[model samples]
Target: MMPWLARSIYRAQEAALKRPTFAYWQALERSQWLDRAAVEALQARKLNALLGVALAHSPWHAARIRAAGLHEAVRAGELPLADLARLPTMTKRDARDNVDQLVWRGVPGGAFRYNTGGSSGEPLIFHFGRARQASDAAGRMRARNWWGVAPGEREAYLWGAPVELNKTDRIKTLRDRLVNQLVLNAFAMSAPHMDDYLAALQAWQPKCLYGYASSVALLAAHAEARGIKPRLTALRVVCTTGEPLYPHQRELIGRVFGVPVANEFGSRDIGFTAHEAPGGQMLLLSESHIVEVLDEAGQPVAPGEAGEAVITGLSSAAQPFIRYRTGDVLRLAPDAATGGQGLHVIAEVSGRQTDFVLAADGRVMHALAVIYVLRATPGVAQFKCVQHAVDRMEVQIVTDAQWNAAAGAAVVAGLRARLGEGVAIELKLLDTIPPEASGKHRYVVSHVPLPAGLMVTA
Candidate 1:
């Protein structure tokens, strides 16, 4: 199937499913070309609308707005972004504790339940609807256009999402072929499977390769070790997500793939926050999110200084994520960093990193694979995964009211599925989960070290 034709057909189907998706996609296409002032104006309009909707439907948000004395300003569309600093910031704990109070479950298109295996300790199951979906899909489409890759173009995902890897039906296989997508499992990237993944990618000749930063770097390292240079003609850019892209990793991935590496900064909670531009700017999807870089004192930081990324997702009408603290440290880039693109710019975001979990069968899996296990398990508060040995894993959990005995069995099953049979899993319920000496919460700590020269981190 021709790439262009596949995109057309997929979009037609998407339009039938929700006409507004295409409308938003097209609007984003034009929005990117708008000036800085215009883009900020659009963000203000959307934020006001989001606040109004949240106040109308969600009593939790209404109380906060009213308490801040900004409810009148929010309703009158006169609230400035700076004034939002006066309001209390929303934490992950706040979202979890007030799920029912925060969600407008009966909004248009209906709020659908979604879960994120976040790198942060708190994994949340929340409700999202048409607006969030459109924001992500359309924003990604526009980002791809920057690299000359269109929707439905031949792209391979080296992802660990269970939903993508679990499909074994003939119908689903045919659908993938029609859409020009090839998915390689990053869940099991052993030397043997890495050889097979390389073969599949070579045969597919995808124009873009997208997946976990560490996994992609591991693949590139493996390719280098074997003295194998992949012969991919159409490949343009390799995009890395799921973790921070270290300098050496980026250099190696680009050198091996014969292309530039584009780093994407976002999490499961905040959908499609930002992507690297061709000019190397980390441009935020300002149309979808309002980002605030704050200092330790809870005030906005000077440009170029490192601070926490406080985000307000403009499209989260079904679930109000107003002034949400993402717990990520980042710095706002100056205009020079963006090439004057005028989109909100991020100089750098140093999110946390976890060591690779080694399977009993010599397979190396991304930490998120196990992190997903703890993240989706309800009733678990703060948690940690420590791979003590090949077959040994210790899970420490801080339970809230939602904790139950069945969650331990589910954890064992989930870990066994990824680490293989005979894997030892012990669940410990704790009063508090402590941070490391560095005051950082290392969600995953794999004591299993990689073979010499196999490490992607410095």
Candidate 2:
């Protein structure tokens, strides 16, 4: 498809879906250049708008706003950014349990249901509106522009979603072509499949390659091992997300792809929060988010100090996640802006670590391969996958009332299907799954290490 035709189709799809993506993108393109004070002022306006929506629709947030004595201020649009601290921060549990009170089903453009990828151990089913969707899409467009990639340009996605992967119908394929996207499954990266992926990329010659950091890095490693050099001449950049991009992984990916590797920081819950610049600074989407770095006691951390990232999504009006505690630890850059841009800077982000699962056939797969299986199973409250050996896998699951013997069998069957028929599956039901000694929750831990030559350095 021609780029012009693809751009038209992309715009048509967004309009049909009632997502104000291009309009938001246009705003983002300009707002990114605003002065610091002006950008913060813009954030204040958006923040108050979000608060007004929460007060009018979300009972949970309304109560908190009232309790914090900001109801009048919200209505009057007088709430300052500093006053946001008065309201309590919400946890993942709170968002999960109080979804009904938090979501506005009748929100403009309608609300949609989504489930987290379960990187947090416990999968959260949440609702978001088209505005939130638009925010994420538009934010990415602005970020990609920083690397000279435009919307509707040929881009390849090494992403995985059961729904997307299962829909192999002609219409879905056509839609992908119309939007200039080629989605290769990150969940299925067997040696043979990776060879096909390399061939596909060489043929497609996408302007950008985007996907999970580990998956992309693994592909690069596979290419190096096989001495296969992909000829993607049009490829401008490799964008990595869904995990912290380690320095060595970045170096490996950049060298293998012959392009600069950009790391994107965000989560399924918070939408697109930040992106890396060519100069290597991670710039927050200040127009769409209010980010606060807080210490263990919930007090604001000094600049340059690491702390948990608590966020307020200004576009999340359908399901207001005001001051939502994202367990990821990050440090703010000492400077407020980089390269004269007003977007807040992040010095470091460290969390969401997923291990690689080695299959019995020696095919290296991303941990999400098994994670998708467990996450889709009903009655699973919390779960973890530990690969003890090539043929030994242990699953610890905390179940709800929906759990049954059949679900247990299905879990075992799913594990065997991915890990191999010869692998021993141990399903252990527990009331609670404990975190690591460092208090971090790792949903997938592989005791079986990768082969000596294939190990990805930290």
Candidate 3:
């Protein structure tokens, strides 16, 4: 499809859905050039507006606002950005338990229910308004443009979202065609599937390739081992998300694709937060988010210190996540190191690392392949996968009231389908799932190492 026609179709679709994506993108492009003081002023204004909505509609946030004595300040639109720390940080459990108290169902453009990706071992269902949707879409657009890939350009996604991968309807196919996009199922990346994906990518010649960092790196390794040099001359950038892009992974991906690799930092709950620039600097979307690095005691970290990223989503008016503590750890760059923009710079990010599971047939697969199976099962509150051996797998699960014998059957059947019927799956029901020794929740851990000649990096 021609780029012009693709852009036209994309614009029409956004209009039909009443999404303000283009408008938000335009605003973001302009705001990126603002000075630091001006950017903070913008954040203060949006923060105050979002807090006012929470105060009026969200009982959970209202209590905190009043207790912090910021009710009057919020109402007056004078809430200082610094005073945001006065309110206690919110946890995933808080949002899950107080959905009714935290959501404004009557928010403009309506509140839509969605689920987190469960990469952190805690799947959460939350509501977000159209503004949050627009912010995410627009932020991605601006970031892609930074790498010379304009909106609606030819792009291919190496993703495994069940909602999208499960769609076999003609409408989904037509949408992909009209938008000049291709979706390859990363969840089913057997040796043959990876070969097919490489061929499809070469034929399609997309301007950008995007997917989980680990999956992308694995595909690169597979291609290299097979001595298949991909011919993607149109490819300008390989955008990696959903997990941390390790240094070695970055080097392998860039070398294999013959392009620069851009790492995106964000999550399902917070929307699109930041993206790496051409110079390798990660710039936050300052207009839509205010990020603070906090120590273990919830106090702000000093300049140039690594800490937890507690974010305030300005566009989350429907379900305001004022001081939401994201489990991922990061370090902020120096305040003066803005990289010619007002957006905050992130020096380093350490996020969840998923293992590569080896199948009985000797095919290497991304850990998400199995994760999708457990996440789809009913009554699964929390889960952890430990691959004890090639044919033996242990699955620790915490179940809710919805779990039953049928759900247990589903888990075993799903695992068998992916790992081959000969593989043994040990299912253990647990009261709780513990974190790794480093205190990070990794949903998937494999004891089986990668095949020889394939590199696994830290």
Question: Over the stretch 1-458, how does candidate 3's per-residue lDDT look in tens digits?
Answer: 89988988998998888788999999998998888899999999999999999999999999999999999999999989999999999988898789999999999889998776455676677899989999999999999999999998999999864423344655776798799999887766777888999999999999999999988998999899999889999999999998889889999998889999999999888889999998889988989999999999988899888899999999998799989998878888865433578888888888777888888787677787788788777788889999988899999999888899999999998888888888899999999988888877889899998776566465
Q: Can you give the TM-score per candidate against the true fold?
A: 0.95, 0.95, 0.94
The true-versus-predicted C-alpha distance at residue 321 of model 1, in Å, is 0.8
Task: Pick the winner on TM-score between candidates 1 and 3.
Answer: 1
Error of 1 at 294 (Å): 1.2
- In terms of lDDT, the poorest run of 10 residues in model 2 is 161-170
Q: In terms of lDDT, which candidate is stronger, 2 or 3?
A: 2
lDDT of 1: 0.85
By summed lDDT, which 10 consecutive residues of candidate 3 come out lowest? 161-170
Quote the positional error of residue 387 for candidate 1 in Å: 0.4
Residues 109-199, model 2: lDDT tens digits = 9999887754568878888899999999999999999999999899999986452335475577779978999988776677788899999
Better of 2 and 3 by TM-score: 2
Q: Please give the lDDT score for candidate 3.
A: 0.87
List candidate 3 stretches off by more than 4 Å. 117-120, 161-170, 335-339, 361-363, 421-423
Report the alpha-carbon TM-score of model 2 versus the true structure: 0.95
